[model samples]
Target: MSHTQTIPTRSSINPADTWDLTPLYRDLDAFEAEFSDAESQVNDLSSYRGKISLSPETLLSYLKAKDKQFLIIDRLYSYAFQTSDEDTANTQTQAMKNKTLSLYNRFFASIAWESPEILTLTPEILSDWYTKEPELTNYRHYLEDTLRQKAHTLSPREEEILSLSADMSYGPQTVFNMFNNADLRFPSIDDGNGNTVEVTHGRFISLMENPNRQVRKDAFEALYHTYDSYKNTLAAMYSSNVKKELFYTKARSYTSTMEAHLDCSNIPTKVYAQLIDTVHAFLPSMYRYVALRKKLLGVDELHMYDVYTPIIRYDSPYIPFDTAKEMVLEGLAPLGEDYLSLLKEGFDNRWIDIYENKGKRSGAYSTCVYGHHPYVLLNYQGNLDNVFTLAHEMGHSLHSCYTNRHQTYINSNYNIFVAEIASTCNEYILISHLLKKAETREEKAYLLNHLMDQFKGTLFRQTMFAEFEKITHEKEAKGEPLTCDTLCSIYSDLNKTYFGPDMIIDEEISMEWARIPHFYTPFYVYQYATGLSAAIAFGSRILSGEPSALDDYKKFLSGGCSMDCMDLLKSCGVDMTTSGPTSEALKVFDRYLTELESLF
Candidate 1:
């Protein structure tokens, strides 16, 4: 743990201090009224079920009605999920999540018309309909993409039944969420002064940065040991999610489950393979960075536990939430005036719940739904990382903000392929701004080390997670079961390869998957790596003080799902279809390694 880490000063700034949801509804009563009206509206969906294809006009109207219903559901569910994540055991909030989810399931199951019904349309008929209907004209791309997946779609009835089972379908994610928040208890850790500090998901990373070696080791063991106790149960839940993926892929008759998943987001499988290949080729840079860190800390050797130690012992500058807001806006000035204004609106209007409060959720993220101001959830400590994190999440929030303003409901939601660009770009901007502001060599070195850590975690570590996902899916494809023992062995081997020969690779590290929430979503974590790679490419362009780069990056933020993910990146001037971004971004990593080693 970084020893300079401290508890957030504004930990008592509860949810009521921010979030003026009055624009969405007057109060909880108003929200309930809207919720009731929506449930009643969706109940009428079955009336037009058989008649959707009577004419193009009729089909277009049905689609609009369906989208309208989804709009209401989106608002309701977004509020519920955000509030629930804040405090998992809050009975009222939990009830809202359940209620909203059930309503979502019902509406989706009742009106699963768009995909299967459109798949039956002849190209000529669809083209004629698009020309005849104004609504259908805007939906041309959306409909075309759905039709392309006709070969993988289930029959309408089966699809509807499955849509109805979404609550059950999300079993693994639900279990993992419960375990993460409510069930798991961590052992206590001793800080630098030997006082017992409790281990928490939020504090674990903080403790990992301790100057004292024993504290880092104790915190690491305490956290993972708790996870290890439940590894088998977590493994079974994880394996079930993987099995669910396999079952869906087989049912759809797709070539592989990966193809089945990518179809949903309109991305190509080549993008995934390209990321894996590029990162694998660049592994030595990451290894070299680790070796440099080992030398800087003056340790006899660096173990897995030693990776987080701070190279500079000076106190980090404290950045409160408001100051951080200004810094974020200043840092992201390259994204153009319109984007900066929207992010500023969030800060002024308290769209951010920026500091941790009692019972508030751990970690940080940007959560958005169409037609509402995007919300950021953070347990903000006044640290440099928290400053950068604010910038990162606001990237995602404004991406949604712009898309909602520009596109129709269906097109506003972007795929994961380009999602990380905004967030990672903000990170680069924050670091660049700070590097410019540094007053000493040690400060610059500390900032550089932190940036290096992000590069390693976001690019290298995520790629490792991605590889683990690929192996598990491939193993399942071969009709093999993924037991706890098998997963442990695979994870341990990966630690050896990625951490390299000099770094101590512990065997119990195999239980790492037990702590990763991303594993529940099969093949989903690779986007972190690809996103950072793309961010580095695009961020480098804009930060170089290039006017065209600023213009291109803003155009990309406004894109949402207006273009395909790969094409969207091409618009921003990076090609996800190739390994160029990953390789080029790794070269930046190599430069940091060189700088870090120079300090040695």
Candidate 2:
């Protein structure tokens, strides 16, 4: 029998199996009512427009009102987006999602005056206001971070104009999403059993891990060939997106687009450069890992298609979604009882939408609604990898849960800089547990290979992507053209450099940049690399019984945007400013590679 998992339609699935979105709204009627309410609130925000700078009390009032408005808006968005994601082909839901997004953009444009108006206040005046209003202490960090960008902040009218155009700014990504998710179709190939299977974004990863190289290569070629056919359009979309970044940079008085993005989280450009530098310095480790993979696979020359396949295949059991939940609970036991209890509560309360159905969104993510439990969406496939994804996203869900419970709404939403730390920590912790509990050499080797893959994918590959982003941005800044051929050449060269001499850098891999959704969001991919480094270091400390490590980790989760990303990591005992964390993560990868070699 073929090892293919059949995906079902949304209507065919049990109601109990889907996420209970009631926490967000009672129904679409309630959602419509809330939408109207949100619009009214957006109109009301103008009342405080000219009054925010008057006094600390007025500022507090504005902040509180805005927070309330945002909460409703968030809930509305979460409901719409998640509902649409359940089945993208549902026209009604997609329309609702589009309307909600438009409302969100309008709300954002309405409040664009807040930042510029707040920035208008003198430092001493703002400090005096802080002293005058004790309640203002709750938003001190928020205000400070806003003021930190005062140099880039434009006049109130200009800021509002920019804010109103925010929806338009997401054009590139929106186009990519529509094309990749809804329109583009992949050709079917035989799964070695005389049965034809169509390629999908969700199933592509599974197909790559197939033992048959022909299937993997066919899938890779088909996926990229489709992307290549639209290379000119994609190139235009990506270039426009990069130029958009440049426009913001120039509009905000920033030196570069990268500086603009990093400054949002108050991260220095040095940190970004250091991440790339540190990873490049450890290229030999990655090269050795690739060499080992080639040796283990018995391939004379490893190609991009072979990268994801398991060298030492394990005859693992099909872990059902319920069993996966239990496994996550067991893997996370090291985090203490309260954490375990909360995890169980999430599993019990229908916080998750598990399994893939027709037109369902690919991959997993955890999103937040202020007054409710964090919601997670998963395309569970009854595999061990799916179990890890469960743990990873739950880490995000619980982080949101903890943050919302402790912090005010204004301080509740954490920055993306620390977002991946929580998720990847869960992944590493689970991997560590599974490694120790493996009953056979094959299992241990499989787990070890998984670790190596994580390092390669997250650390090395992301850094390479970061480099590509930096280069393309610089080229665009220097008035160089970013055509299809240019992007492919740049990306292809980086592939050769990273994969080393042993691996064949297929031309199809050049178009890989066009396929990545993250490239549209410049400087975002590097966080995964930085995040994994911090997670590995923190996981080591906690598992080794470092004092106050768990407490500090929990505190970091709860801190939300109350502190800068670096400070949050520092509080958790990993300083990202230096190369220490990245170096240590590389060392951990080396250790895993050694173990995998010994086991093999």
Candidate 3:
């Protein structure tokens, strides 16, 4: 039987299990009407085009109008995007999503003149205007941030051309999305019962953890074999993607693509550098973990396919969706009554789409339309990982809730730099609680092993990816063409270095670079490492009874771009500038390793 048989169509799924986009728009007609109105607002922006710097009054008025325009367009896009994700096969919803994006592209082209015009003013003049108009205080950070990029701000015509290119820039991502989700298909494999089962990206994870070594190897080989066939196409697509980054960085006169991407969040390039360095220094722990897995499984050699299967069978209880919610509530109790109450409100109000459905989006995400409560999308499977996913996504939802309540509309959206902290903190706290409540030695070992895996996947693997991106981007920065052979060689070497001598270092692993979507966004994966590190620091503090720790964390959540992301993290007591938090996180990982070894 096909595993997807258990998945339901959008119409067959229960209403309560899906999110209510009604909060965003009452109906499709409402969404259409807003789209029309937002287009009008975009046209209206022309009136303020060259007049943004005429006076403090003009700038403030333009900013307010811009905020209003964004609010409407974003809401329209959010509704359409979620509707399309509800069922990717729905052609009408997909058209709406496409139309919404087109409108955004037009809107972006319209406002492209605003930045360069604003840059026309001197920094001193902008500062003086801020004092002259106290209302600009609401957007002081936004204004100053704009000024900070003055050196990189292009001419008005060049900016307009770049803005127009935005729509086409998504070409590589669009191709990957279509291929990964819609076109790609995997062949069936034997289930050890003489039954053949079709493989899916989602089911591949479970198959890798199957006890039968042949089953795991078959799944791995089948999946990568499919990818290998398309390696040339994928390499070409990714090459174009990297060249686009190079184009933008060189166009804007930045030193490198990594610097350009990090500049958006005002994060120091050194943070990215140090994360890779620190993880490299501590890689022996990763090797040791791999060696232990090899010994426990009694396999002569550990292959890439064998890495995910648990050394100790968890035999964890089958947690239904509702029970998972209750467990999450209990696990997150340390975050205090107000945060808990808000979380409860989200659960009660249908803020989450809680299960997988055929043609629905494959993974999890939390998105907030500024006026409405935050929305979380999940493909809950009732496993331990799903339980933690519930807690993890709720972390994002509550962070949105807190920021929406505290910050202005413009400032309501937090930066990606600090976005992952709350979600990871929730996961850590939930796992910590689970470990404490584990009754048997096997259960405790399972939880500890899960923790170790989390460290491996998030910290070590992501850092390795971060390094790969750094190398590739730096290479391209020096005018090196990222051909298939070059990309594969660099990726293969890094995989071997990170996984150590124990792993079989399958040659197929080299093609892994063509598969990671985040590579489309250069330098984006390192945040997972930093986010996990910050979570360990923050979660440990609150759990260890550090006074006011929870409050400080809440403060960090409530701060939505009110300050720089790095500074906001510092307020929460984790510094990414140095290797301190990353070191502490690795120590935590080592402690869990020691515990898991002792349990054996």
Candidate 4:
């Protein structure tokens, strides 16, 4: 009989391997008590609805009360959702999560009049009121931001209707989440040894990294074929998500979904366009790298499955989790002792749920409540990429930790635009550190391959994803149908353009779009590209021991939503408005490619 590897159940995992949720709530009973109190607090917020602009005092009181209500609601939602994520198949926790979402919707509906009513207060009146109530100065930026959306602000009743429709709008994402995480299953394949291992969402990428080409090819085909079987349904789910964004875009009177999404962070549409244009200018560099990959692997054809495997062979492909942690700490030491101290704190405490369990959500993310510490979810497969993921998510967690400790609730949550910068900067630092510490030519080449892969994945690959989003969303906006064939065709063409003629664009790779969760959130993947550019800039400065580089970087992390994201990056001495950062980052990629080629 052959040995079969199976995912352990959640109950079977050691407590230390899981995140400690006790800070949010001691147990389900405590969560319910807070949930009940949150409902009453949300209802109480309705009492200030019509009187929002009556007086500055009334406005301040309402703002404070609303903030208080949200603090509780945030804790409740975080707890419920994290619990449900622990086991997506658990009906009880799913119900708990849904209940919190409903409470949030109710909270939104109750405060629907906030922006419109605030808009009624004239600039002079608000300025005068600010002096009368000095504390209102705290929300000056928040108030101005609301007023900035005056043209798009809907009527109170209409806003309430839209708020109530939140759950309906979220339906596609919810359904897709449940299907992808819980309902969908993949076939088992040989582990390239005598053992047979089951394919899973968490295991798919690890399988792709297998040294055996047959194993990589098998996992790729199996995973995509399963997704391909549900192509129509997945297409509909994606189409619905696009339509949902369109509905809100038109409702808010925005001309384009891209404009609408970018406007939330005050980012210019040209920033998006500039990224695409810049990446296009560097496609030859990407092609050169792809050719190098093909040459080194010495394969007749480079397929999508061949992309992830390490080009240079090195001992110990499997890094133990404990070793990964120490490596991350050492890699990030350049960020200073204070930063490392926090990373150590998270490690000592159960701030991370570190392994995959049956029915647990796939992939990794860092999330937090305002007053509590951040939590990270991971499906540790003991691969180098997983090690990078560990460092990546801890970057996010520590960013949140810094912002939460420094800013009030209103300003603590940074915009998604800047969110990736912190995460990717950590990755850049880690890769550089690994390269510097390499003991042999094989090790150096291996780390170089990993570094180049990071650039390929983050800069080139994410830009490709960004382009796909732009094309698909534009097509949908023009009333073209986003059927499975249309989407697959668009995605396939992008792969051809991005990977160049040297690489074979496999049919299974076309269905790759269906599996990307980021697509559900419009115009998001571009940040990964933009973020890499900014991160590389910052990483270079810090590694060179530039004066005030580390300090400026930490200040940016602590700034959160206190300033416009563009201004925040500008303060860190990286002006994202121009193409300098992206172009510079690609030059770094080119340099690495040259070094790697010389080694071979």
Top-lDDT candidate index? 4
Per-residue lDDT tens digits for candidate 4, residues 309-423, read 9898788557888999999999999999999999999998999999999999999999988988899999999989999999999999999999998988888889899999999
Q: If both were scored by TM-score, which would come out higher, candidate 1 or candidate 4?
A: 4
Two-way lDDT contest, 2 vs 3, winner: 2
TM-scores for candidates 1 onward, in order: 0.95, 0.97, 0.97, 0.99
lDDT of 2: 0.88
Q: What tens digits encode model 3's per-residue C-alpha lDDT throughout 1-600? A: 534234577889899898888989999998888888887777788899889888998999999998988888999889988988887767798789888988889898998999899888877887898899989889888888888888899998999999899889988987886677657777789866666777776667677877789999998888888988998898889888888999999999999898899999988888888888889889998998999899888999999988788888667666898898899999888888998899889889899998777677677889998878999998887777778878888899889989999999988899998888899999999899888999999888888888888888899999989999988888877889888889899988998999999999888878888778788877888998999999999999999999988888988889999888888888778788888999999999988898888876
Q: How many pairs collide in each candidate, listed in order?
A: 6, 0, 0, 0
The residue-by-residue lDDT of candidate 2 on 230-298, one tens digit each, is: 999999999999999999999998999999999988888998899988888888888888998999899
- Please identify model 1 stretches exceeding 4 Å from their true place: 1-17
Specify the poorest-scoring 10-residue window by lDDT in model 3.
1-10
Cα lDDT listed for each candidate: 0.80, 0.88, 0.86, 0.93
Mark the 10 consecutive residues where model 4 has the least summed lDDT: 312-321
Model 2 lDDT at residue 159: 91
lDDT of 1 at 124: 88
Error of 4 at 152 (Å): 0.9
Cα lDDT for residue 193, model 4? 89
User: Per-residue lDDT tens digits of candidate 1, residues 1-600?
Assistant: 334333333334554545656666677788789889988887687778677667898888877887888888888888877777767757787788789888888888887765787777777898898878866877777777777788877887888877877778788888788778756778776686846677877777767777888998988888778878888888898888888888878878988888888878878888888888888788888778777777777777777888777777858767767788788888777677887889888888878776554455678888787877888887776777778888888888888887788788878888887788888888987887777888988888998899998988899899899989989888988989999999998898998888786788765578888888878887788898989988999889888877688778777877777668888788678887888888999999888768767765
Model 1 residue 460 lDDT score: 86
lDDT of 4 at 28: 99
Q: After superposing candidate 3, which stretches have Cα over 4 Å from the reference?
A: 1-6, 193-195
